[model samples]
Target: MRILNTIESALSGFLFLLGIVISLYSVFMRYVLGASQSWATEVYTMLLVWAIFIGFSTALKEDKHIAIEFLYDKSGPTMKKVSQVIVFIIGIGFSLFIIWTGFNMVLTAYSQQIKTIDLGFPIWINYLIMPIAGILLFIRFCEKAYKYFVKHEEVTHGGDVEWKQ
Candidate 1:
């Protein structure tokens, strides 16, 4: 679990840094060099996609995914657990759907040899980020569910909560 968390964090961090660097370079090229590469936009778009996907899993592992806590905080432990289960099921289902659809989309893109307007780079490569991120999210969801049901552990007040389900 620790290793998974570390890997997810590292991946997310690397994607984020990569995105920042690419964006900065793009900006520098446009402003300082007075010329923009046709592929700059595509590069940024790809980086953003990767960052979003990796960030999704990292957020799940960190229990930083968005939620409405007003009602949850007022509920009892049993209710909390029930809520967690419901959320997990729904979240996992949605992530799986994305993975399925994203896979098909990537396949179609690859088969068609889709390319961006300005860059002419293979569009499938950019679309691949969706499935990759979806898979990571699915893994994180399973880990959360396992910890919730099998580990039966609670996070401390100041510590990160092992998301129940």
Candidate 2:
């Protein structure tokens, strides 16, 4: 699992850097070189989506996603555990939904011969990220739930987080 997490992180980091570089290059080309690109928009958008989906798994592992902290902060340990369980269940549910719908979407795109407007790339290739990331997120959620419920531990990326401590 740790190895998988590391790989996911590496992919996410690569995508982040590539997306920024491409976006910057696109901007420079548009404003500095005076050559408007027809494909830049589509490329950047796809990069952004891919980065986001890939990053989602690491974000869950790091516990960086948004939560209602006000109530959680004041709650007791039992309440906190309960909340975490609930959140984990919700996350699992959503991830499953994404996996199912994403598979359907890819099939639909493939069957219909859908393509990106600017580059004409097969749309299913882009939609493939959804199910892949969804599975990753679901596994992370299950891991978290196991730690919280079975091991009775608080899994956090930052042991020095002042608020959590």
Best by lDDT: 2
lDDT, candidate 1, at 132: 81
Query: Candidate 2's error at 127, in angstroms?
Result: 0.8
Could you estimate the TM-score for every candidate?
Answer: 0.87, 0.88
List model 1 lDDT by residue over 85-127, tens digit each.
8988997998899899999999999999899898788888888
lDDT of each: 0.79, 0.84
Clashing pairs in 2: none
Give the per-residue lDDT of model 2 (tens digit) for 1-165.
Answer: 989988998888888788788888889999999988868878877888898898998888887887677888788978977887788889999999999999999999999999999899999999999999999999989988887667657754343222333
- Candidate 2's TM-score: 0.88
